[model samples]
Target: MADVARLAGVSAQTVSRVSNGYAGVNEETRRAVLDAMKELDYRPNSAARALKRGEFRTIGVITFTLATTGNVRTLEAIATAAAREGYAVTLLPVALPTQDEVRGAFSRLEELAVDAVIVIMEVHLLDAVTLTLPPHVQVVVVDSDAGNHYTVVDTDQAGGTRAAVRHLLDLGHETVWHLGGPEDSFAAQRRADAWRAALAEAGRTAPPLVRGDWSAESGYRAGLQLAEAPGCGAVFVANDQMALGLLRALHERGLRVPEDVSVIGFDDIPEASSFLPPLTTVHQDFAEVGRLCVAAVLRKVRQEEPERGTTLVPTRLVLRASTAGPGRRDAE
Candidate 1:
């Protein structure tokens, strides 16, 4: 910073204001400071900056895989929102979720002196480590109910699944079979719960649950089971990706969608509607989830109380051609 100031022919305070992105610095001065910084290859020490201002403009986000389509969309939203608010994000990958790994990651973020942290991991075990975060640093968990003191932003998984079931029922399906995501995921659990509740509400028995690991293969296996099961005319898959696999499996089994089996999936991913028999699925705005999570962290850093202890972003039901009335059940 001193080098930048010297090169720019400005006082240290002026350099500080420019580096901290204070609005009072004139555009010309800000540009000059930036050019000088580029020439000198000067990098502001975020830790030192935090020490001076009692907050870091940097946030740490811990999550499982950014490889997944849903996860990537969520991350993009987080990055966009953080940048708009003049905060830089540092992503910490929790490759394999274990208690020790999660705790260690948070401890490292704390040591890095991030002002606030957001955990986007979806597994249940994260709850234990998240609950122990230092009180001074604010934390928010995405897509899980960890019972932590800090904020939690989750998708209305149950509600979305319920909507899918209701859609099928309204189409006159006798019952909706469920192909669920991995058993360990909070999302999978919530969707399963909702599907069950919706069935019970309609005075119908919930079909046996078939599990998938949010993958095409898992969905294929579950779809195979459904294809052979008698009276299986309608199926609700937990995610779009799995639905794709399920579709393929059903196709191989000579089961025509809607004509033979009506399949509805969750998470109306970009490709869902383009499948061989366009998918009917639930859509979740994960990007909104990410943006809100970052905003929540900012509120904590600004010493403002966030309105909700836990925020659940709503999901919408997308109707495509994949699902229709449960046509002509095979006579007993």
Candidate 2:
């Protein structure tokens, strides 16, 4: 610090202000301090600073698994947003959604230097576990229904699902069939519930709800069964992977898409546009969701009134070749 101050021709206090990112220093002085830092190879001790300021400038993230596209994409977005905010991220992957697993994750976090936590489970097992978190550590959750209790940032699952079903019904399908993800997934349940509500509102009877493990293979298996169902004209899948599988099953069954069936999917994964007959689906603003989560959590970290209830990032319906009016060849 003395060497940097001497080299930059500034007092040690000025150097401290620049090093700590305190805002009073002018741009020229800041640049000179930075040049001195670079030339002298002087690095500030972050741990010492953290101890003094009571802030680690780190955010911890917890998630069950990264096998799913939504989790990985959202995690990436959160990391990017955190970096932009000059904060580092620490990730702790819980092996399961069980309360024990969640509690274990919290125990592990206790050993880390995180100032706040962001849990990306999209599961409802955190309500009890959240109460056990350190009081100083503000938490923001993703993809769960704990909004009434904790700060939440998630996609508008119900809104997106309604749009998907409405699109299919307006295209002349008598009723839309739902190929839902795992029953325990909050997102999947929201989508399934919305699908039923949308159908009911349209005065259309919903067909049996098919279950998938969020896998294309599961979707393919479900598709085979649906292919045998009477009056199966349009389907809304939980995610894009399953939608891909459903398309293949339909193809194997010699059913032409749009000509025989219409398919809609969620997430709008990158490959969605290139699927055999591109997938019409719900476009989740994952980056936006991630950014908002960081913002909300950091607000608490900064000791602002923490956001309660849910902050829903809106989704859009992406039009593609996979959907059309019943028996029509072109997409709507």
Candidate 3:
């Protein structure tokens, strides 16, 4: 600390501000402090500082898994937003979110004495674990309602699915087939519900629901079956990765996209556009979701009154070449 302060020609308090991400330091001083720290190879002892301050100036995030593109994007956005607020983020990934695993992660965070916790476990099992957190710890849930009391931030999965199905219906398609995500996921259930409701509202026979584990391979398997089925003109996939797989499967089966099938997917990932035919999908603003979650949880931690309920982030459809008119060659 002394060496960095001497080299940067700033007080110890200024060095502390630079390390803790406390605002109010001028740009020149902040740059000089960073340069000095880099030259001296001085690493701030986060643990020691956290112990002394009773506040880590850091938050812990728990996610069910990082296997899917949506999960990964949400976590990245949360980290980026937290850093901008001068808080560090620590991610805790749970491969299989058993009761013990969730409990254990919270216990560990309790020991670290972090300011708050954000759990991204989007399954039903997480609710059991969240009920037992120590009262002092403020918790915010992502994509799942932990309970009515704690803060919850969720994407408008149902609304997005409704939009996609309605779009297909307006395009003169009689009915839309659904390629759903894992049964355990809250998002998949919401999407499936909305898809069914839209069909029911129009007095149409709801097509058989195809299930996937949010993987491209599973979507490809479902696609193979749907491609062979009669009157399967339009499909709404749960996520883009599976949509990519379905597109490939249709191509290999000598079926033409938009000509033989029109598909819509969720999560407008960057790769969606670069596909052989650009993908038509829904966009979830994960960065906004992250920012909302952080601000929500921190408000509770700071003893400020924030809206005490769930927040739904809006989604939009990005139409692309993957969807088009049903051709005259439909199997009768």
Instruction: List TM-scores for all candidates, in order.
Output: 0.86, 0.90, 0.85
The lDDT, on a scale of 0 to 1, for candidate 3 is 0.85
Q: Write the per-residue lDDT of candidate 3 for residues 200-302, one digit (tens) a residue.
A: 8877779899999998899899889888878888999999989988998889888898888889999998999998689999999999999998888778778
Ranking according to lDDT, highest score first: 2, 3, 1
Question: Candidate 2, residues 1-332: lDDT per residue as tens digits?
Answer: 99999999999999999998899999999999999999999999999999898889899999988989999999999999999999999999988777677777877886787888999976764454543334455899899888677788889999999999999999888888889999889899999999999999999888899999999999999999988888888999999999999999999999998778999999999999999899999999989988998999989987896658999999999999998887632222
lDDT of 3 at 327: 58
Q: Looking at model 1, which ten-residue stretch has the lowest summed lDDT?
A: 125-134
Q: List the residue pairs that clash in candidate 2.
A: none
* Ranking, TM-score, top scorer first: 2, 1, 3
Candidate 1 lDDT over residue span 276-303, tens digit each: 8999889998878988998898988888
- Pairs that clash in candidate 1: none
Model 3 residue 94 distance off true place after TM-score fit, in angstroms = 1.9
